[model samples]
Target chain A: MNELVANLGVSYGDVLLELSYLLAAVFFVVGLKFQSHPLTARKGNLWAAAGMFLAMLTTLFLHKDADGNGIALTNGIIIVFSIAVAGVLGAVIARRVKMTAMPELVSFFNATGGGASALVALIEFSNPNNSSTLVTLLGLVIGSVAFSGSLIAYGKLDGKVGDIFAKWTTYLNLFLLGIVITIIVFILAGNISYDSQKLLVYGLLVISLIYGVMFVMPIGGADMPVVISLLNSFTGIAAAMGGFIYHNQAMILGGILVGAAGTILTILMCNAMNRSLFNVIIGAFGGGGAAATHEQGTIKEISLSDASILLSYSQKVVIIPGYGLAVAQAQHICHELDTLLEEKGVEVKYAIHPVAGRMPGHMNVLLAEADVPYEKLIEMDDINPSLPNTDVVVVIGANDVVNPAAHDDPSSPIYGMPIINAHEAKNIIVMKRGMGKGYAGIENFLFFNDKTRMLFGHAKESLQKLVNEIKTL
Target chain B: MEQAFEFFYANKDAIFIIVLSVFLGIEVISNVPSVLHTPLMSGANAISGVIIIGGIILVGHADVSKVSVNLILGILAVLFGTLNVVGGFVVTDRMLEMFKKKK
Candidate 1:
């Protein structure tokens, strides 16, 4: 009886930690599967979050030091304070920030996350205790990359900086990276004492931070989604390093899972945008000049009432939505317009490019929320064919995705990325604030087309006005 | 049946928390927009900030010999990952609110 009891005495905490990890993994799988369809996305998110929490809890409870204490009292205090500060700050921001600043707020948070990681690495190197060559090297690479990369993404998303830095910026980064590498080599050469090693590590940490900043500084606003994914991957890798440092199985497994998932997501986002990861990086490398915004002075314009008249007579219609839809919070109104058009016996379908909004499938979610039927939400492949059959394509605050670079200009920033081909439709009606360049800072050829008519205004107001005109008709 | 019951008795805390968190997380994410993938991810990138505090605690408490360096480095890693999580959550929430109709 005692032998059986002893066999089972292997402590419940370890078993629980492993079990929690399993649950977390399950949640990750479910969350990822639900990403393509909005109907299941929220559930998917919750699953992923649950998984993360499980992983975090496992780490919290399972960690044991040499003295047999579960976690030091100081460690517990730190955790409490960190949670309190972060939770309060998060709540305040959530309560106070306007919908218009939501995207910027999100970007800022991402940057802060990256900065925290890099700072952690710095503190580790600064410490007199727990020095290992392998752990230091891992922290150096992952922490630095995540920190600078996230900041640049934040800057681009906020329009604080443009993608594409000065021509020499790339070279400068290369030079800085080289110095850090050489220093690492020197430390590993076995000639340096402990104090010297600390200095070298500190120097490298500074360079790593700069590298992270430089990496993101040049990426254009349009590619922020991909950059975010890439940074997420870096953070995961950094966490994995932390796991290795602490010899924590849960952290290692969780970090690796996050890293792998983030890498896959970044690739998918890049593919959807029809651009290579290399191009995204180079695009971020800004050249010194006037911003690369597309502003054509010569496009013909039309009134909403005239737009309504044209739509009233058109045989078929395609509706294209972009960030402006989200900004204007006009998705429901847009859906209303679509319904009215369909009622008039004009066939209507929504055209969605993969990278249409700030996120991968943004337009679909916003439209779905507005009660647009699932079948009406057409992907790039499905909608392009219908564009030629359509008599009118009403573009609501979309720019880069409608630009003709996919068909005509090879040198353009958004070239080769799949677009909605609204230009091929008999008539185009674009509702926008003005002829401002999109996230890519390039001109759209669709605006210059004879069939294209700019219905200049905020998407919601303009859409409301169009709805009124349609009702009158 | 005895082993199963015994396992449940021994690991009740772990099982309960895991199950409950999974249920809660699933419920919250079910309503958020799929487009939030990007912003959530970016926000997660921000959560990496937590690693910094983790590093500080780890290093500050570590023995001044072998693990000290590792703790400090670990803290950095935690910082980055934490930042990502915090930021990711913030963005996810913001993106979800976008679906909410304007007042």
Candidate 2:
């Protein structure tokens, strides 16, 4: 079938190929537009998939030479088999990855992206005709870093890796990066022998992999969202480098889109954490959120029934969700409580910190899964002003986001971070497993505030109890 | 195997688009509301999977010298690019599908 199609396609292959690729790019744009809203997201994805399929098909059947011959039989077979297997694996992973593990899964995907782009650069460099040494090196180095960095990110998120990077690790990382640059400059200057160039490529790949791992090791957990975004952008830029090597328009455009978006995301997340892009890259903010010297504080407990009453009669209530919410899978019951309160003529809203949860947008996705209205899910800036007027604030599974030290204590690691003003509310109800510190590893001064009341238990169980008690009220 | 300068000269327009699109992408995706950030990231990454086309073209280019190194690298590129495109779009779809607007 493919042979027949290729034979027929050879007649007007350029037009067919270019037109199909153009259509696919259009679909990608439309699909992205669709993804912005709940109503159109699924269909948008389908459109994008259709685009990818069409692009793949054109390359497979219509790509031909001056003599009208097709791709090498062995190469064609290998491509088909690999795609078939990858499609199956992708489908399985898409189905199997839990909501809580999305961040790690994303990192895993990013690793593949980075690794793949680097491979393309390697092959292009090997081809004597493709002598774009600069472009190849950019793709090779950035892609390798993204690959290894993402793996470490996955390990960190999954808790399989621990932070052991010390102050000297930074100096070593800089030194290694200097070495990578020196090798690239030599190759670009054509100072290396042809035989040794290949060896240098291998050496470069290894050093980049080490650099990537060292990068994330000492960075605080509070800055993970930023690191993840930065690495994601690296993958995009790397793809563009490969595209430059291949002179492929679609790859270039697609890479540019992702690289740009990821850059913006990294910036926004860094701003949310009150850190500069420079600070994040230098990674001097070490400790991985390890425990700090904590101040003593008195704990005040609130009864389930009292919590229900306080929530039931409140004029306005805001729920601040953190990683613990997703960790305990409390989003569903939390939404149930949201509705239960809203049904009683109490206004309810969700205050979402950008860096909340395990990854970017983690709480929003979980809450949206629970059928929370988009309007009720508010950003920190939009929600903080109303926080002072909120009659009751229910903080579920969240910690550093609501910690007042971000604003009040300059000595705190996360001192300058923007947080929800949960403490400003007339009543504050904190649902936690214990008095455990948040990811920032600092005592939540809000926990010791006069208005704060701790309702301790698993987030899911506690929210369920709140639902049950609210029904009685 | 055109040298770097010739390749740049020929695809100046393409390079220009790449640089321009970087800014455009950032502006368009600036505020994707946190709820959609993950899906959008996945979606954006899916777009990068267009590198699959590059992989396919590189290995399958009619002018490609069937050197063993080129063949092996091409195969690896195909595998990685396919995995990225397939996994990225599927995961993004799965994430988007899970969003149920409040009743």
- Chain B structural similarity (TM-score) per candidate: 0.48, 0.77
Q: i-RMS, every candidate? A: 7.1, 2.3
lDDT of candidate 1 over B25-53, digit per residue (tens) = 33433433335555445333432332433
Candidate no. 2 TM-score: 0.88
Q: Per-residue CA lDDT of candidate 1, range A220-297, in tens?
A: 676777877777777766765565455444444445545655666677777777667887877552322222444444
**Model 2, runs deviating above 4 Å:** A1-11, A33-44, A65-69, A284-297, A313-315, A340-346, A408-416, A468-473, B1-11, B59-72, B100-103
Model 1 ranges off by over 4 Å = A1-15, A18-39, A72-78, A91-106, A123-132, A162-164, A284-299, A313-315, A324-336, A339-347, A368-375, A408-415, A432-443, A448-450, A457-461, B1-103
Q: What lDDT tens digits, residue by residue, belong to model 2 across residues A281-365? A: 6764533342345555789999999999999999999999988888888888898998899899999999998878877777777
For candidate 2, what TM-score does chain B get against the true chain B? 0.77
Question: Candidate 1 falls in which docking quality class?
Answer: incorrect
Model 2 lDDT per residue over B28-98, tens place = 77656766777877777777777787678776763334457667777777878887888888888878866
Q: After superposition, how far is residue A274 of candidate 1 from its true place, in Å?
A: 2.7
- Worst-scoring 10-residue span by lDDT in model 1 chain A: A285-294
DockQ per candidate = 0.14, 0.56
True contacts kept of 1: 0.22
